[model samples]
Target: MKQSEFIPLTLITGFLGSGKTTIIKNLLQREELSKTAVIINEFGEIGLDHHFIETSDEDLVELSTGCLCCVMRGDLQEAIARLLTKREGGWSFDRIILETTGMADPAPIIQSLVLDKISAPKVILDRVLVTVDSVTGLKSISEFEECSRQVAFADILLLTKTDLVESVEGSLEKELMHINNNAEIFKSDFGIIDLELVLGEYKRQTIAFTENEIDKHSHSHSHSHSDIMSVSLYFKKPIHAVALTLFLELLAEVLGSDLIRLKGFVYIKEAPETPAVVHGVQHIFHPIEWHQSWPYERKETQLVLIGRNISLPWVRAILETIEEEVEETTRQNEN
Candidate 1:
C-alpha cells in the first residue's frame, strides 16, 4: 500500500495460443492498468501482439529475453533498470507485467526478479498469473515440462477457453486438485477475467516452507513428461473453509517434493462463490488467500492439476472425507 515501496510485478505465462495474447490484449483496456507497463518477449521473428497493442503513451515496451529460462536473469535486470531510467526521464511507470514467450519456463523468471544486480534488484514478484486452455491444458501438461512448471509456479491460474472445453472440464478439474489444492482457478471464456485478479500491487514474498504449511496433506505424484496427465473427482457440497485449508496444507506437504505447482478456486460451504487461491513451490507452500470477488460468470469448486501420476481416487477420497468431516462440524455448531 505504500507508494514509495517498489511496485509488485506479475509474470504472465502459458503455452502458445493458450490465450496469453488475447488476455493481454483485453487487459490493456482496463483503466486500472493505464499506468501499467508491459515487458513482452517474443520467440518468433515477428511480434504479432504488437499490432494489436495501441500504446500512444509509450507505457508498453518490448524486451525480448531470448529463451526465458536461460538468459532471464540478465535480460530482466537490464529491462527493469531501463524502465526506471525511462520513468525518471519524465514517463512514469507504475506496475509491470512480463509476458513470457509461449515456450518459456516461469520458475527462473520468478526466482530472478527477487535477486539484486550491479545496480539493484530487477523487481519484486507480486504473483504469477498463468493462462491455460481449458481444452488443451492436460495435453500440454503431459507433453511439456514448461507447461507443467508454468501452472505449478503460478499464484493465480486463469483457465481460458472454458466454453470450448465443457467436455474435458471434468478431467482437468480432477488433475488440478491433485496437483494443487491451494490455487484459485478462474475459468474464462473469450479471455475474460477481472483485471484485479490479474493485476495486483501485493507485496512479494518467497514461498515459505514452514512445518505447519507443509506438514499436512502430504503425498507425492509425478509423471514423466511423455505420460498422459489429467484427473477429476467430485465432492459432496458444503465443506468448512478451515478443514479445506488443512486438506491443502496436507496435500502440499505430501506432494511438495514431487509437485511442480497446485491451484484452485473453491466454493466453501461457508463462503460460496467467493474463491480463495493457493500457490506453492517444490515442498514450499504459501497460505491460502481470498479473492476480492469472483471474476468468472459462474462459481463452483474447481481445482486444476499440472503434475503427473497424481492419483484420482486418492485425491477424490481425501477431498470428500475432508468435506464430510467439516460439514459434520458445521452441523454440530448450529445445533
Candidate 2:
C-alpha cells in the first residue's frame, strides 16, 4: 500500500536433519535472492549456518535458543514492518527467508501474522517451504507434533536426505498428500535442486491464488493460538556497544536455556550512521553485524527474544540503556 510493496515471506521449516538449512543455503545462492534477508533460527546453540552463507550484504541472521512461534512471533512481524519503513533510499529485499527451529510448531508464527493487524501493514504469507528427511520420514509423523505441523502448514514440500533411504519419491509424495494434500512435494539430495525448480514452485503457487483468495485465507486462519510466547523490548535511545555486548554475554551464559533466540537492532554510539544488529542462538553467539544504513521509521533500539521461562525484567534495565545514558564506546565499525 505504501511505497514498499507487500513484503513476501518464505517460511522454511521441518524436523531435525531434514536439510531445511541446506535447501535455504541453496536458495541464497540464487541470483534472484542476492538481496534477500534471511533469519536462520536454530535450537540449543551453535550457529554454523551463518558461516555457510557467502553473501556480502550481511543479510543473514541466526536465531538460537528461542523458537519463532513461541516467543518472537510479534517481533517477527515488527521486524518485517520495520524493514518496510527503514529506508532513506527505499530499501527492499527480493524476499525474506524465515528458518524456524527444527523442534517448533510453525502454526504460532503463521497465525501471529494472520491475526496481528500490525504485521499486515505491507506484508503477506508468500509461501511455506517444508523440508522432510526421507530417511526419518514416517516415524516423525507418529512421534513429533512439530513434524506434522511443518507438513500440514506447508504450501511447497521438499523431500530431503533421500540419498540415505531407498528412492521413494512416489511413496513420499503419497505420504505428503496424506498430511497436506495442497502442497507439491519434490525429491532432493544434499539440498541439490535446480534453483529454477525452487523459485518456480513458489511462482506457480503465487499464480494459483487471486488477491481476494489471500485475504480470505488469511482471515479464515487468523484465530489459532498456542502456549509459547514471543517478546520484544524497546529503548528510547540506542545503547553503547560495550554495554549491549556485556548484556548479551550474560544472557547466553545465564539464561541460555529459557532463551531460544535473541535478535536486536541496536543503535551503538560509536557507529551512529548505521546501527548494529545481533543474532545469537543459545550458547553460540554471532558477533553483532552492523548495517550500512538504517532501514526504518524509528531510530530507537529494539531487541527480540523467543523462549520459555524468560523474565523480561531480568535485563530490562540493561537493554534500555540509551547511548547517551551509557559512557563512551570503542568504535566497532561494520565489516
Scored by TM-score, the top model is 1
Clashes of each: 24, 15
TM-score of each: 0.62, 0.55
Q: Give a tens-digit lDDT track for model 1, residues 1-335.
A: 34455666878888888988788878888888788788887776567666676665367666553666676667777777787788778886678888888888776676566445343323556777888888888888777767766766666778898878545466565554434444467777788788778664443222222223332323333433333233433343656788777777677767664555454566676777566665544434445677767655456555544455577577767888877787788789999
Worst 10 residues of 1 by lDDT: 203-212
RMSD of 2: 17.2
In candidate 2, how many Å is residue 10 off? 0.6
Clashes of 1: 24
Q: Give the TM-score of candidate 2.
A: 0.55
Q: Alpha carbon lDDT of residue 173, candidate 2?
A: 54
Q: After superposition, how far is residue 228 of candidate 2 from its true place, in Å?
A: 21
